[model samples]
Target: MTNHKVDTPSKIEWTELYNQLLDKVDVGIHVIDEHGKTILYNQKMMEIESMESDDVLDKDLLEVFKFHNNQHSTLVQSLQTGKTTKSKKQTYFNNKGQEITTVNDTFPLLQGDRIVGAVEIAKDVTQLEKVIKENVLRKQNTKFTFNRIIGQSEMFKSVIEEAKRATRTSSSVMIIGETGTGKELFAQSIHNGSSRSTKPFLTQNCAAIPDSLMEGLLFGTKKGAFTGAVDRPGLFEQADGGTLLLDEINSLDPALQTKLLRVIQEKSIRRVGDTKDKQVDVRIIATINEDPLDAIAANRLRKDLYYRLSVVSLLIPPLRDRKEDLSLLANSFIDKYNAMFQMNVKGLSEDAMQMLYQHDWPGNVRELEHTIEGTMNLLIEEELITAQSLPTKFRRRYQNSQSSIPEIDYPSLSQDEEIKPLRDKMTEVERMYIQQTLEANDHNISQTAKILGISRQSLQYRLKKYHL
Candidate 1:
């Protein structure tokens, strides 16, 4: 028979190893006696409470340390129960007067089935809680991505690539796209991906604020600079060492544009009433719906500022130009609204999808999203959205176009055609013609309006009025 033996370490060596293991553990451990006096505590526990082991040992638990109502009650309940209470209780104040939140489990120490003391195990959970909160906020705030940009066409791919490339640089990027093309999204992506990601990313709509308030809003005002003037830092200062997006920058007043130019050029700003110049390290990302060159020529944008901002200009293609991405975007919005409204509406029907593809989205992605949301709100059943489920204007637009071909006019056709007044007939013809033109132009309203010898705004008004 073969003999096998296992060797064990000495008692002293084992004790040292156990102590070393407990010392390296991340959780805090402490023990209190039946008299409410601390008998043992680990280094982690002392560090967590910001107290030394020597100072805490033999100290009355309630007298030496104050706990919040929740923590105190939890500990007392555990002691009374003579059993462990595992919970996520928070102790508010630390030694430094800062709030410290922790998750703790308190267990009663048993000596022959009699509670002699209690041991508490805790972990610092402040950072973990903060991370969880931030994640929830991020999920709630932004969910759309390139897929949500809508458009499967090659034009969209080119624009996305340009946007991706612009995100890699600190150079001022100017996104030139018609209103509602999701320019803000591209700007957000750039800021989120840049080296200044951890810093503040601010957005100011140049058109949203009036000229009178523009200076104060962008460069900030000093105390008593104006009525009810409290000292407040402007967006430029607030976004210091970060990125500031100026949306619809062309809408700024000419003088404000000049001041903005200097801020962008010199990398500094002088507050409204302050003489001292404060240095700012801010990256400017401006968006404009108009052509920068045209804006400069019209004195709407300063030439120098326009040139500086256009150092890396990106043009976001209109949704109509990227028809291929329509299905992807439509489905994305369907899923989003489905979850948001808690509705069971699944998706668009093939005919509804065809109608979507055929329609010219003058308002771009924003318009599409709104349309989908509106449809979902009006949906009556769980079935797919059909042409009949579409808005009245869309139905009229589609029906008028379908009937305008002037085919063989039978009684049924005659009833469908019902010769109305000349003005009404002309209006119907005009509407159908416009729809056909927009469809032919792939929903490019600018080109369609030009071809129809009408203003783009006029076309937009008609589309909205007809719910097209």
Candidate 2:
């Protein structure tokens, strides 16, 4: 026993493992020394900032990225003050003039009682900004009315009635449901049913938006507020005398929620970079994809703001919870699409309807609608949708649930089919595993990556390679 030798990893080996672990995380990780020089930059951070290790390693933060001032940089501010900056949204330009926005949480690394360096965790929202901008530009007036809402279930009808009652008053309304459960549809119907239906109806999704930009987007912006800034009306102003739908209100920054609470209390708004408070009579109808209590417990939503916005809260049941309406909804969607495509397609076959009922419908009604639409695309001479005609994604799920054997782990090869090379067979197996894992996680890239035991970057590469 005394002569037995134990093998342990060396310091260098441990360091290499630590670095690899950092690169696997979905968010960007950056570390800087007290002198503001980059010490450790992970792979995700490099991808997010569009720079390589050669451009950032051992370089000053100011030299690598363009910030208005030292104070504007979260890592720098944390280093100088030895204070933490949590979930602060920052927008800055890289050396290539490409604007990057990230939600950052920075902490000062300390040695005993002295600050030594700082580490930052950032989540990029640059693409989200572009999507929000495009959506805003393409926004049209509300077209959904209560009459257009299709649901015959008693529970569904009760919620519809509650929403109808909400339209009679100007009080704030909160619609709660899971994603794709038709929260926005209910929101639009409420706006159209209200007395202020003739007025402008505006919608803004608060999720994944930077706070700085969100502030100006919600409140008006004053002239010369920032570079190229002009006087512009925000959602509150645009939706004046009408309803403003704030989708996923919990996603809004806590500070912005405080401002919103004040607005609801005073019925007024103060533009960004302006001192004057202007009155607005916009009715607020907010939506949340989770339980409000959970959002408050997690500190994602402010409690006081929830009370102000939920004067008339309506909860929409998930599709699985109210399966009585499944056939009604499916037939409606089929008729709508058939009219749009100018095709006469009959209703779903018994097996097809059984497949629909077998699913828990994690995506709810919207998922069912999309399933029908996708199945329709595969139809040519077939007038009715059979179980065999469903999209591969849905069909595979049904098959896997019914099969005793795990078809997922081993791809089926027909005896008469041509044999493929080992490389091609392995590639096909890898692609299938990635696709199934992605579907299991509801197409969430980060979660899918984690489930697949790979980095988000690697998962994205596979998605592009397989066109999944």
Model 2: clashing residue pairs?
A: none
Per-candidate TM-score against the hidden true structure? 0.57, 0.60
Report the Cα lDDT for candidate 2: 0.83
Output the lDDT of residue 183, model 1. Answer: 89
What's the residue-level lDDT of 315 in candidate 2? 82
Q: Give the top-scoring candidate (TM-score).
A: 2
Off by over 4 Å in 1: 1-151, 403-468
Q: Candidate 2 lDDT, tens digit per residue, 267-298? A: 99999989999999999999998778778989
Which of the numbered candidates is closest to the native, going by highest lDDT? 2
Q: lDDT values of the candidates?
A: 0.75, 0.83
- Give candidate 2 regions above 4 Å deviation: 1-139, 399-468
Clashes of 1: 4
